[model samples]
Target: MNASEGLWSHLTGGALFWLTLTLVVYTIVDRLSLLARRNPLANPVLHSVWVIGTILVVSGTPYETYFDGAYFIHFLLGPATVALALPLYENRRVVLRSLVPIVAALAVGSAATIGSVIVCAAIFDLPAMITISSLPKSATSGVAMGISQSVGGDASLTAIIVVATGIAGAVMATPLLNFLRITDRRARGFALGLAAHGVGTARAFQVHPLTGTFAGVGMSLNGLLTAVLVPLAASLIGG
Candidate 1:
């Protein structure tokens, strides 16, 4: 092979190329988002997913091949999840005061989120496995995969559902909140994170620190609740 052609093939085939390309593309979109007055519609995660997905489709890169290169970024999800506690701790007063309500809301929200999906899927005559898998779509993607496994659901499908759920919530958050007159940043953040998980948390950070902090709490709490409740509910139903 010619030197330039060989080098191009080598770079594209390497993990560094895919990983760096992902980050650089995401960064550019994030900056564009900011330039657009931080428009909610111009979300970085939404755009990044679109751009990367398009690239993969165009390049004929198998999902597995892309994931192999991107696994390092995926590995950091655990650390990022644990780091969510810091913000929750920073707002410990709010957490402490609303502990009862937080727990109560989580229970109801988790149940409703899972149950609603199941019901909708049933009405549409979706396969049982798909319905079960989608139950954890509101949780963080990693946790959703685990829950999907436990519930005999498809992990890959759950991952896609989780991202779709996040993008839907992130895009609708501003308009919905304004319409509902939900002016409290903390409340908005919490609702978004509860509904959207990490993607929503990122969007919250773009809005304000306080918003992001509460979003962190909601994201973590909702994930914890769904992780525990979903499998148990599946068992109860399956039994």
Candidate 2:
């Protein structure tokens, strides 16, 4: 093989290459988002996914290979999710004052999100497994996957749906909220989190700290609720 081709193969075959590529791609897209004044279309996660997916496809790289290099980041996800609590703790007083509304919204929002998915699946005549898998789509991936498996759905499909839901929510939330003329940051963030999960919470943080805090609260509570609700709903439906 030629010297350049040999070097390329050597680099691409290593774990460090994929890890570096993931970080660099994300950083570049994040900077572009900032340069674009944080436009929703310039969302870093969306762009990163596009760019990285393109590269993997073009290079004929297996996802498992890419993930091997990037597994450390996956390992850190649990800790990162836990760190979301710090913001909630700092804003405890404000959150506590809105406890009643938060609880009410969580119940209504969780049910609506899950119910809508189930209804849509039924309307489309989708398999029962698909409906069960999608029931926890609004929850974060880890929790969503567990709920999906416990309820006899495909965990991998649930993870994919959870990610798609989050990305769609993160991208459309600002525009949707503005179109509705909803000026309340807390409301916006909570809705985003409840509907979108981690990606939505990240988008909320980009807009405002208060919004991010509420979004985190919503995401956390929704995760817990989905765990219980999905199993109960599955039983009710005889799934």
Predicted structure with the largest lDDT when compared to the true one: 2
lDDT (C-alpha, whole model) for all candidates? 0.86, 0.91
Error of 2 at 156 (Å): 2.4
Per-residue alpha-carbon lDDT of candidate 1 for residues 1-239, written as tens digits (9 for 90 to 100): 99998897787677888889888998999899989988889988889998999998997777777787789988888899998988887889976886776677777777888888867987899887778888898899988899899889899999899988998888899899999999988778888888899998988888899888878888998998999888877786567
Model 2 over residues 144-191: C-alpha lDDT tens digits?
888899988999899889988999999999989999999999899999
| Cand. 1 TM to true fold | 0.93
Off by over 4 Å in 2: none
CA displacement after TM-score superposition, residue 135 of candidate 2 (Å) = 1.6
Instruction: In model 1, state the lDDT of residue 224.
Output: 89
TM agreement with the true structure for every prediction = 0.93, 0.94
